[model samples]
Target: MRVVVDGMGGDNSPQAIVEGCVLAQKEYGVEIIITGPKEKIEAELAKHEYNKNAITIVDAREVISTNEAPVKALKTKKDSSLVKALDLVKNGEADAVVSAGSTGAFLAGCTLIVKRIKGISRPALAPVMPGKNGPFMIIDAGANADCKPQYLTQFAQMGKVYFENVLGVNNPTVGLVNIGEEEEKGNDLTKAAYQLLKEEDINFIGNIEPRDIPKGKVNVLVCDGFVGNTVLKMYEGVAETILSEIKTEIMGSFVTKIGGVLLTPVFKRFKKHYDYKEYGGAAFLGVNGICIKAHGSSDARALKNAIKVSKVYYDTGVLEKMKSAFAEEKDTLKIDE
Candidate 1:
């Protein structure tokens, strides 16, 4: 599969992006087209030994900075690296696009350029995060802040499709994020959403509390972007804080230091298990084409994994299955017209 990457988008820019492209190409044997200034892209590529035929570069001089307004940048800078990379997927020149750039611009470009699947109300950000048992997905994770009850139902449906097809989880349990497990625990939105989800054909597991989320028993958790974003950020923040504190305490005294050395392997495994790098990027689900938004501060390892995501997405034909679900499972996937 051919994937277009935004070379000028991330904090590390062309360096990490180029390195990741080379690594992804070498390991996955996927064609990569990187969009950025030709000179900068080449300078980084020269440091790595890769096949010239497998990796192509498209010169896009403009770049959409994080400071710029997403919509205005999209309208003004048609030749930007992010926009150009997205265009490759939109125009059928590439199978997917991956970026670690401005999340705003990337989401806007996906919705306005690549467009949404027919009958889908809006595109949602679904990030597969590390949980107690394994990885769990959170839908509407910082895409649309405000949503209707019907929107949450759609998120659950899309999340269900993702788990079943891409994740190889048959009949994955779906849960709505709420304050408590009861149907009447949340506000009007959750109350209404709970009513709608139960009628769907997928495995609806009722309401899931934020505290119980990391347990990973619920495969897919659906909520409005506001709640989803809050949960995601808090989850990340808590993990980082706890890990940092553990390191600090371990180095505080001789006794702890000795114990720390003994448990180094366990600590390393724990950190790796919770690291966001293991998950790579979040998919912009409900779009017509694949768009994987990598972390802005990602290094080569994370970027390589993000590119690998697109390949798996392509290999499994997830988008086709999503379309088919919308077609055949019309009642379940639809929001009120």
Candidate 2:
């Protein structure tokens, strides 16, 4: 399978992205098509010794800036690396596309160029996070700011198929993010979503409170982008703050320093749990083509992991399963305005 990478989008640009492509090709034995300026990509490749045959470059003269408006950029910068990479997916030249560029640009590029899956109202971004049980899949992670109960219920259905096929979790339990575990705890949105999930064929495990998130209450957490983004940002902030505090305290005193050294391995283990890069990349689900969004600050290893994640998506036949899953639940999804 061919995995396309936007080589000129991130802070490190062609260098880190090229390094990632080489590594992923070596490790996963998959073909990589890098999209960027031919000379720049060639220069980056010259710096490293790799199997040159495993990598190919697709010349994309333009580079879409992060500050540019996503929808407008997609139209104006048709030859941009991000746009070209998505085009590869659209033309069937690649199995999937990976980008570390502007989130909005990637979203718009995928929507406009690669298109959305049939029967899908909107394409949602779903990222897997380390949970108590294992990896937990959270959907609409800032893809759609506003959502209806049916949208959330659809996320549950799609998320279930994703975790089962990609993450190897069978019959994954679904939870609606709410103020409390009680059915009547949340606002009209969550309440309505809760009722809809209960009526579906999914394994609805009641509601999941914010407190239960880190403790791994459920395998799938479904929420609107507003709430989902809030939870994601909060979790990131808290994880960073706690790690910083631990580092400061460890170096503040000699006694604490000794304890820190003793607990170094344990701390490393804990840090891995909070490491977003460890999960590889976030998949923009419900799209016609396989598109992955890597963290902007991602290093070569993270980029490589993102490529691997795309292959997993391709192999799992996620799109096919989604079509069947949604078809089976078609009758249950009809709602009154």
Candidate 3:
């Protein structure tokens, strides 16, 4: 698989991003295409020994900052690393795009440059989050801030495909994020979406309350971007705060410190389940091309893992499946894309 890396994006741009491309090129053997200022990318590449044939460089002088408006950035920063990397996918120069740049800019570029699936209403930001039992997905995580009932229903379908192909889940159970498990709960939006979800040919598990998310109640959790974003941030925050508190209590004194030493291995194993680096990045589903949004502060390890995700996406042919899924329904389904 040929994957493009935005070498100028992320907090550790060019350095961590470039190092990550080398690691993935060596381990996964995916052709690495790095986009950024050529000299800067070259300097970073010099730090590591790699097969020159496996790695390619594309020079992009402009950069879009995290604070810039997403749409405007994509338009103005035409030659940005983010834009150049995405262009490679659009032009079939690469199979997938992996970037840790501005989320807003990245999403905008994917939707505009790479384009959405033929009939897809909106592409969802689906990330495989480490759950209590195992990893699960929350679709439309932050892609579309506002959505209709039908949009949420489509999210479930796309998410189901991902669970089966990528996560190896068969007939994955799905649920709508709501205030109550009962169908007659939540605002008008959830209530309407609940009914639409039932009509789709999926393993719909009814409404799933926010409290049930961390427990891994369902494999594919569906919600609009606003709610999904809140759930994701809250889950991450609570887990991090709890781990921090545990560390503080573990170091109360010499007696507790000895106990902490004994439990260090256990803690490491437990923490691994919640580490964001393990998952790498979130896939922007429904796009015509493969676009992954790596964490803004991704390290070399995280970057390598993100490339692994791109490989899984390519190897599994998940994008092709998604295309076929909506392609057949275009005639019967009145999708107003």
Candidate 4:
């Protein structure tokens, strides 16, 4: 398997990206193509004494700044590193693409270059979390700001396919995100989506409110990009803040210091559950190619894991399965029409 990475996309570009590529090459035994300024990438590679043949560089002179608008960047920065890496996926030079650049830029580049699967209205970013019972997936985790009820059902179907095939979850339970558990508690979109999900043959588990997220109530949660984004960001922020406060409280005084010493192992265990690095990255699903959005602050280990996740996604035949599943639905829709 081969993966193309945007070498200049992250906060610690060239260095961290190159290092991660080296690690991934050594571990996963997959060809890695790095797209960025050739000289800079080569310099970083020189710093690391590794098997040079395992990695290749795709020279790209320009870069799209994170601040630029998504569409504008895609149109103006045609030769940017992100665009070039995506082009490799478009041309079949690489099996998957990974980047830590502007989320909007990555989305635009993926949509334009790799394109979306036919019969799917929108591609969603579906990320899995380690839940109490098993792994859970949330779609449109920050992708589509506005959504139609039909689009959400499609997200559910895509999420189900992801959980079953890639995540190894059988007949995953799907839930609509809402203000409350009752079917009539949310806005028109949620109400409609709730109805649609209940009517579907998949394992629709009624409404899942934000308060129920931590209890691991469902395996798949569906929502619009705006709502999903809010939930994810807030979840992340709350975790960070809580961790910070715990650290401060533990180290505050001598008595607390002694208590912290006694609780050090337990604290470590708790920290592992909330670590973002463990999951690697969020995937942009429904697109014709595999694209992962790594965290902006990712270290080399996280990026290496992202590459590993890409390999798993490729091995699982996720894209093809999603296409076939949605195509079947579209066929039924046409019959009804």
CA lDDT for candidate 2: 0.87
Collision count for each candidate, in order: 0, 0, 0, 0
User: Cα RMSD for candidate 4?
Assistant: 1.9
lDDT of each: 0.92, 0.87, 0.91, 0.86
Higher-TM-score candidate of 1 and 2: 1
Ranking by lDDT: 1, 3, 2, 4
Cα lDDT for residue 324, model 2? 78
Model 1 clashing-pair count? 0
In Å, residue 310's CA in model 2 sits off its true spot by: 0.6
Model 3 lDDT tens row, 1-337? 8999999889999799999999999999999999999999999999999999999899999888899999988988889999999999999999999999999999989999999998788889999898888788999889988988889888998999988999899999998999998999999899999988888989999999898899885899999999999998998789899999999998899998999999999999988878888889899999998899999989998999999999999999999999999998767554755
Q: Quick one: best TM-score, which candidate?
A: 3
lDDT of 4 by residue, 1-337 (tens): 8899999988888798899999989999999999999999999999987777779899999988789898898888778899899999999999999998889899878887899888788888887776666667889898899888888888888899888888787898998889999989999899888877887778998999898886666998999999998888887798899989999988889999999999989888877777777788888988998899888877898899889889889999998898888777786432210
Question: Sorted by TM-score, highest first, which candidate order results?
Answer: 3, 1, 4, 2
**Higher-scoring candidate on lDDT, 1 or 2:** 1
RMSD of 1: 1.3
For candidate 1, write residues 64-100 as lDDT tens digits: 9999999999999998999999999999999999999
lDDT for position 156 in model 1: 85
Candidate 4 — what's its lDDT? 0.86
